[model samples]
Target: MKTAINTAVKTRTLPLAIADFKQITKAGLAFSVVFSSIAGYLLGADQIDLTVLLLLSVGGYFMVGASNAFNQVIEKDLDALMKRTRKRPVPSGRMSVPTALTIASVFTVLGVVTLYVVNPKTAMFGAISIFMYVCMYTPLKTRTPLAVFVGAFPGAIPFMLGWVAATNDFGIEPGTLFMIQFFWQFPHFWAIGWMLDDDYKRAGFKMLPTDKKDTATIIQIIMYTFWMILASVFPVTGLTGTLTLSVPAAVIVFILGLGMLLFAFKLYNNRSNRSARQLMLASVSYITLMQIVYVVDKFL
Candidate 1:
């Protein structure tokens, strides 16, 4: 009986622990962030160094995980108020604040150390991304809609951090990468905010550009998306440092941008939750495919 009870207890606890880990670290989001960073690394690398790639993948995930864990700790109460976030580890009572903090602290140290091994610049940017995300963007979310703008700074760092990891330098190449991601966040997040405005309002998060699902907000989303596409193709003009895009690759990227733009226009026309969700999905596809185009163009 004792052995059977222990077995059942372990079985129950194991899945809960895994759930807690995934919630605190936001595994899917972290993986996407790491994917962009790796794409940047590949773009900048002259020769693929598996060791550096391995280190970058691990370090990037750790850094994003640490940021997310800390953000959860800070917003535990607010998270509980939102239907979407209420089931998260901290808010749902699956994990303790202290435990989450400990995990974040450890991840931060490991991430920084691992990135530092790649280069000082990479580690420095990684640290800045964490600090800005936790100390600045997290707190500003409830206070102002400008929080998205502030968050963009840290959100854009991953792609550029990879380039710095490869070249150990900050230049136009990484700058262009940073700008591309920076502009991409507005439309991507605004689409999410449009879809979840109610949930966001329940938590008092000022996510929308105009603080309402209005024409102004949709206009801003369209505007930023336009700028994001322009930034993506700027490299094709051979103006952005070592980064260059082939004409065919540029055409493919432009077509991808158009697809996203059409979705944005759909949101503007109907202003329905479904349209917003479609725009959100399109935005994700746009960024991912654009990054792939950039990296693949370089090798071919």
Candidate 2:
């Protein structure tokens, strides 16, 4: 009976632990960040080394996970007040702050060391990304609406970090990649901010441009979508070094951009949560598909 009870306890505790870890890490978002890094790596690498690829994947995830863990630790109280975030590990009481902090510290060390193995520059940028996310962006979220703009810096780093990891150099190529993602975040996150405005307000988060779901905010979203679309085609302009986009790929990218623009317009027209949600999904699809198109165009 003792052995059976132990077995059952272990079985129950294992999955719960895993689930808590996932919650603390924001695993899905981390994976998306990793995908951007990988896409940048594929574009910059003349010849792929599986070893470096593996290191980037592992290290990149560690860095992002650490940022999220630290953010959760810092925002646990605020998170508890927000319905959307109330169930997170720390907020929900499934995990302790000390445990989350320890995990974050461990991840930070592991992430930096792993990235350092790739190159010193890679490690440096990775560390910077973590600092910006946790120290700057997290604190700024509750204080200013411009937090989105500040957050964009670290958010843009993964794409360029992968390029630096591959080339061990920073230049127009990585800068262009960085710009593309930098512009993309405004529309993407603003749509999310719009959808969660109420939840965000509950946590004292200044997410939207004007702190309300008004015409000015939607107009800004539309404006940023245009900028993001323009940035997406910067490679085709012949100024981005090796990160060139073919004419056909550019057309496809433009079409994808138009689709996102359409969603932005729908949000403007209706200004409902459903429209915001659709715009958010379209923005995600736009970025992911554009990255895939960029990689495929480079290889093909």
- For each candidate, the alpha-carbon lDDT, in order, equals 0.95, 0.94
* Cα deviation of 167, candidate 2, in Å: 0.2
> Which residue pairs in candidate 1 have backbone atoms (N, alpha carbon, C) closer than 3 angstroms, thus clashing?
none
TM-score of each: 0.99, 0.99
- Residue 203 CA error for candidate 1 (Å)? 1.1
TM-score, cand. 1:
0.99
Clashes of each: 0, 0
Per-residue alpha-carbon lDDT of candidate 2 for residues 1-300, written as tens digits (9 for 90 to 100):
999999999999999999999988889999999999999999999999999999999999999999999999999999999999999989899898999999999999999999999999999999999999999999999999999999999999998888999999999999988998998899899999999999999999999989889999999998988988898997898988888999999999999999999999999999999999999999899999999999999999
Clashes of 2: 0
Model 2 global lDDT (CA atoms, 0 to 1): 0.94
Instruction: Specify the poorest-scoring 10-residue window by lDDT in model 1.
Output: 232-241
Model 1 alpha-carbon drift over 4 Å, by segment: none
Estimate, for each residue in 1-300, the C-alpha lDDT of model 1 and write its tens digit.
999999999999999899889989999999999999999999999998999999999999999999999999999999999999999999999899999999999999999999999999999999999999999999999999999999999999989988998999999999999999999999999999999999999999999999999999999999999999899888989998798999999999989998999999999999999999999999999889999999989998
